[model samples]
Target: MAFFTKEQAKAAARRSENMLDQVAGLESYSDERFDVFLSHSMLDQDLVVGVAMLLKEQGYSVYIDWVEDEELDREHVDKETAERLRQRMRNCSSLIYIATDRSGQSKWMPWELGYFDGYKDGGVAILPLVDTVNSGFDGQEYLGLYPLVNQVNQRLYVEDASKVHSDFWAFVNDPSR
Candidate 1:
């Protein structure tokens, strides 16, 4: 997995901020059942939950596999489970893939991303949540091929949770992304 420099990350963040300002009041256009479908490795459950909580606090409705049903084993994807995942992907306005080291080897994260990509083309915002350790994003060559959230650092920039929330909503609501 490769990473992006701080300069590149800042540039992306600036672009996203500018775009958010341009489309500040377009939330009404987003009518998806859920604001975001947070895709992550089951191993990163703690981090995923933290991110979900932060988004929920900002008044964003987030959908995660664990929140749906504990008994639903994702390891073995039955026909019903597959359908359920598909439905959830369709309902969400965007998909934010928690791109941690664990997620790099996840069986479900890539599948979920591919599913969402096929479902909406460029309509749904597909973003990646990189680690904040070094403020550098690894696996950019792979994840960068698709649309991603713009943040100051490699992380979600949750230090200012509102900015993350607003940027995500703006990205998803904007059809021109």
Candidate 2:
């Protein structure tokens, strides 16, 4: 079956061109305000919250899925929540995945990484971190991250908050990225 009509493709092309013009208009202050989505595991909850607070303090609209409490009756990492988080990521200008050595052990984290991998090829900006690499680190499934690594624009150490923001802003302004 055909994925898109010829006319639909042409309209999409036109919309992309218009978006370029809009992006050019916001080139100056792109860093001050951007659509950001945070993909992180529960193990890294503290780090995610800290980053969210910092971004909010800087006046950015950050979408952190784990920041809000989930319904107790439903499975915390069920399909519903994943889809909601995926929607938020799709709407954002950038995606940030908080990586810890323990990330590989969790079933949901790898699934989330797969979602980010798809976005990277679509020209979405992705930023990932390697917080630690010990016993905890060895347990991490670096294999899962291999596909997205090439798409990563910045590989900051987890402790570096300033660097994360800097890279995030850079992605926001980079037209080719």
RMSD for each model, in Å, please? 10.9, 16.2
- Clash pairs, candidate 2, are none
Model 2 misplacement above 4 A: 1-34, 68-78, 120-167, 173-177
Query: How many steric overlaps does candidate 2 have?
Result: 0
Please name the candidate that would achieve the greatest lDDT relative to the true structure: 1
In the range 78-124, model 2's lDDT, one tens digit per residue, is 66666765665556666655444445556665566567557644323
Instruction: For residue 85, give model 2's deviation from the true position in Å.
Output: 2.2
Instruction: Tell me the lDDT of model 1 at 132.
Output: 46
TM-score of each: 0.66, 0.50
Candidate 1 collision pairs: none
lDDT, residue 124, model 1: 41
